[model samples]
Target chain A: MKAVVTVTGTDRKGIIAQVSAFLSEKNINILDISQTIMRDRFAMIMVVDASECTEDLASLASSAAEMGKDIGMSVRVQHEDIFQAMHRV
Target chain B: MFNSTEVIETIDMIEKEHLDIRTVTMGISLLPCVRESAEQTAQAVYERVVRSAERLVPTVGQLSREYGIPIVNKRVSVTPVSLVTAAFPEQSPLVARALDRAADALGIDFLGGYSALVHKATADYEQKFLATIPEALAVTQKLCASVNVGSSRSGINMDAVRQMGGIVKQTAESTQGGMGCARLVAFCNAVEDNPFMAGAFHGVGEADRVINVGVSGPGVVQHALSFAPEADLTEAAEIIKRTAFKITRAGQLVAKEAARRLGVPFGVVDLSLAPTPARGDSVAHILEELGLEVVGGHGTTAALAMLNDAVKKGGVMASSRVGGLSGAFIPVSEDIGMIEAAERGAVTIDKLEAMTCVCSVGLDMIALPGDTPASTISAILADEAAIGMVNNKTTAVRVIPAPGKKVGDTVDFGGLLGRAPVMPVHCGSAEKFISRGGILPAPIHSFKN
Candidate 1:
């Protein structure tokens, strides 16, 4: 299933590296990723296709949560349709 | 890496400078759902609105979160209820109730368009709808109402004006002296594409489905003004124009993306400098940036007129569909620059009135001295309504007569509405003129051959 992941929290060192490494290890292909720093908070919206992933959606979410815990942030995984409905237009 | 001081200053300016979007309104016109029966019509209206707006609140919240730009209000403006009211006079109140229910169900802040555009004379259904405005507003929770009684092209509708004068008084009294005024605004030359509430409504000619965006950034404009003090007139104009362009571009981007995601046609982007309680992002600061020590000076009106025009010119070029009252606002209490000007004797009621002649919305967010009689307030509203009627543009009055505030006393309405130092009113004999309370005759152009 195509999934979109949004990561938002305080800006810190190694955030991009940590998140990218995790995604790569899981074999999740990133379709698009955009990030910007607004006022001091860091926000990133990434569209990914997880059809080829070794793990299920639940495991991917759990792993993201673990990564979020390591970096003091919040991570959410949503279906592509929900993401579009919520973020697109 | 950015310097800490620079970051702090930027943040400080945003906090103090008034950095915020005034509104993010979702335009949903309700004409396509018209049906033979009132029940069918209401059902169609409800279903279409629920389906279209079901995701509006969440989408707006997500955008607000994603951008970290505060979106102050999330509102909806649909087709005027009067058009549909013609089908069932007895069932119009139910329609109003249904709209309120939809607004509640969808979590939209307010739903406008319990309206009638009686610029000349009212039809039978129009009169019925107009009579029901007060009850409709009084009963509904989130439904805002407006009446457009005159337009510059059509001239003032003296009959409607006289009726509205009585209606305003009655509506205020019906709400137990509360004015419920926040929920209703009497406008002249009302615009169809406005996304602001208390005065927003979808026009009859709009597409069945469209998404218009009202993007506001008073703080960003105020920041641009910091560079304005030393700049020449041309330079100052360019600076404001460029800043407004960027702000409008951001709105355009959001609207395009939002429409694409929602599977709806993208509508216009309303580029108005809507203000909040914040400090640096004030419409008054933009005026101040134009070399005024304070707003409401001799040049203030001219400066605001230029700024308002320049914003429209730049915004229109940027987007294909630019509508609404797309210009700078000069609400006294809501803008810090204006409040400061009023406090310092740089701004006055009359100057603000004159400024409204050229600005986008008229007589917005003003605070009158408590002792200022109701007659005077009515007179002020009358004068403003006349200007809109003559100009054939949208203008409104949202004045708060603080019970205890005297001239020079500062009253803080807390957030959004902001604070204002009581500005002086000309202590003159408008009393006799206003007390006459007769309809000012409609202008010559009102008669169509």
Candidate 2:
């Protein structure tokens, strides 16, 4: 039960804070976090352990998406297996 | 471990490129459902399908949500109705209706296996069953029917082909603007475990209940090609194979999960790059993306041959179970790019027939003028079947002769079946040839013992 969350938008203050707050609220643990802002475009990727999350993965995804919408960023949460299967043997 | 770029790539494929599991088909054997009376058999068919496929939609929804990948269709394919109704004959439509009702009850969009395998000859009951297809399909919203008029081993059944030509027209004439014609397929070398429709059927050899998956990612492959537009054909082939691997792996995951949750034995992952009506999700567009000015240009078949081979080469290793029509589909009405190509006269029936020689299937979802004769349709089937038989592959025809419509007009089925512009058929007649009904003997190479 792991998921990958991606956030992309124009750089703004507290984008990570907002996203982290939503994840923590769902009891999802942050396993890894990477973020960078290049020429005003902010891109962040987070890997989270969702097995122990209070909410379902789909619900958490929608919550993050809604929060990202409020902050004018595009956000997506997808199962880690899809990426693993695509990129690895 | 996957890097962030790889993660985003997978997400983008699903989100923007319309990557999806085209179908999760549960093949239910209704051999056990046959009763002495057709009415009783129909009832048994209803109960058996409902019992077997009760959780299909809900399970598919759960899996779709869990993986965040769209499962576009949840379907069921039963044992071919001809075998079940071999004794009952005239009352087979009852079984078709019952299956349709079961589909409605299960909330599935379509159900296949209202079919007959008359490649050699037809039984009395099969002949009676064939006559009910137009009525059965026109009456039911989700029932699909297919007839195997030819096979590599047994040769082409010209009698069945001729009958099917009239039946195809009858199917169209029965429905408004020939929409029912969209749901029937005539095939040479039809497979047992196809998960896609309008051609899926649970062959007699299939197990009782098994889950078969058809995965699609035309846009994903097309997007991958866009990254290396200047690459040579070899490099392009490498890129397509890699992309197809990734797509098939995702499909394997979904198929395994869907089967696990539904408690059905996993059958196979059909690695077809099935396209939709959407703009980016088209096989024709993929060919255009590979450097063709249009999908039906001079080098289109070469491009498709590479694509089809690359898809199989990549997909073969991604899953232990793989079957069905696992290649690129260029159904005209179902693809926006193909529809556009046909409209512009860049893709013709002749060109499509040529393309089918290299691809997995043939002559899918094309439209012809309303007045096109039945014999012409039979001729089309004969030609397509010859290619499949000689080449040792599967080929099919699903043409709609739009009633009261002519070339330059359009026929729209809406939703996934999509739209088509009427393309003209050859002016010549094949009446004498088709009327001389007999078996076109199996290809000489078919004897490989």
Candidate 3:
């Protein structure tokens, strides 16, 4: 299963490192990553392959959300189909 | 990799603008459920629905979680109970209860098809079934009923319309604050695959089982328009079209997936901008964004015509399976903006009727004065049905006469039914006109052959 993890908040150091490390721990592989910071707002989109992850997508999403909360950011993990379905055909 | 902006836009629509799958309705045919006795029929009906719809609620929940969009309602629309109970129309309430119990057992809200189609003429059995509607609605919590009284091909069934007025009143009187009337509707040109209640029934022509999805995003359209406040009407309509396209695509995806997982044939996506009582999620608010000071203002119908057309135009492209009432809904009580407009006396039933000509449905969720005559309700239905019959469109009336409540009083149904302010009706009686019962003859335009 492929999912997109989006993180948005005030920019800070180690944001990518922390998120990537969290994914690695869960056996989820990052297929692509994009990040940009405009003024004080920060945004990053990570496309991850979670087919090998032991935890289910719902549980991983909640855990990622919890991690985001602790770091003072808003994070969401959603299936890629929703984005493709909306933006594509 | 996906565009971050597009991702953020979709998220904003869901998290902020209240875009949602209004309903994922499984249409189950109850034709085969009828048995030798009413009790046997009721039992069979319950079992069939429970088995067919067992996975409906949980499947919808999983999809909602996976898609990250809210699926607001999981509903079932069965074959009209009138046909299922035709053997013993007098005991139709038994079937209604069984349907209600099926809804309860399936953990779904509002199972529709407690209906009678007397658009041309009311049969003796149908009349008996019609008499049971008020009692059926009063006895069941999750059951919704609809009656078809007019069509372009058959004109208006004034007799059925007359009966519906009294039926609406009785339903109101039977339930607290006339809330049961909220679950009943009188229709002209009623569709078979509509997923919205209280007018949804699996038409006899439909497949044995199908999935029809109703998609809602008035808030998304309003939000899109907010970005183009200075745009002209044409440009504003473009914005609505683009937003509706995106919303419907998501709905189509959900509909296809929900159908595939549940092992039902994918039906259609009802591209309706149905409103809820929540602030920022209103079709009336979208009208106000188009420069009307309020929804019922002078240019409201023109704006709604463009909106309704643009929604259908865009939605039709998004899904080939677009059906149901594919336009904007203006239910008074269910829209916070419309509710406020009515509270301030700016929106009236007269203006609502005019708006319905261009929109999807008619006279929805309106609260009339407690003493409003049943004949007057019949007249309201007659006028709305006439509009629909002439224009070859679907129109419905779902008004509640709040018992012991007059103008300015409010009836709070809570949840999606919302709060309705009792609006005054015309004092001039239509008793004589309604009492003269006969068919109103098909419109000349209906003879297209």
The stretch of ten residues in a row with the least summed lDDT in candidate 2 chain B is B1-10
List iRMS (one decimal) for every candidate.
11.2, 1.6, 1.2
Name model 1 segments beyond 4 Å from true: A1-89, B1-22, B32-44, B63-70, B87-92, B176-179, B343-346, B369-378, B401-414, B419-449
Each candidate's DockQ: 0.09, 0.64, 0.68
Clash numbers, per candidate: 11, 0, 0
Mind giving the per-residue lDDT tens digits that candidate 1 earns over B1-449?
A: 22323333333333455444566666777878779988888888888788888887777666554433456677788888888768775577777888899999998888988888887677788877777776776677788888887676666555565556555555554553333555777788888878886788988877676777876776776676675567777777776676667567657766776677677778788888887556666778777767777778789888888888878866666666788888887777777778777778877788888998999988876666666665666667778888876666678876656555677777676566677776766676565666564346656765666
- Cα shift from native, residue A32, model 2 (Å): 0.7
lDDT of 2 by residue, B1-449 (tens): 55767776777788889999899999999999879899999999999999999999998887777677899999999899999999987888999999999999999989999999999988788888899999999889999999999899999999999999999999989998899988899999999999999999999999999999999999999999999989999999999999899999988998888889888999999989999999999999999988999989899999999999999999999988999999999899999999999999999999999999999899999888899999999999999999988898999999999999999999999999899999999898999999999999998889988
Better of 1 and 2 by DockQ: 2
Q: Against the hidden true structure, what lDDT does model 2 obtain?
A: 0.91
Best by lDDT: 3
lDDT of 1 at A38: 54
- Taking all chains together, each candidate's TM-score versus the true structure is 0.77, 0.98, 0.98
Clashing pairs in 2: none
| RMSD to the hidden true structure, all candidates | 6.2, 1.4, 1.2
User: Which candidate ranks first by TM-score, i.e. highest?
Assistant: 3
Q: How much is the lDDT of residue B46 in candidate 3?
A: 95
Per-residue C-alpha lDDT of model 3 across residues B17-117, encoded as one tens digit per residue: 99999999999999998799999999999999999999999999888877788999999999989898888999999999999989999999889999999
lDDT, candidate 1, equals 0.72
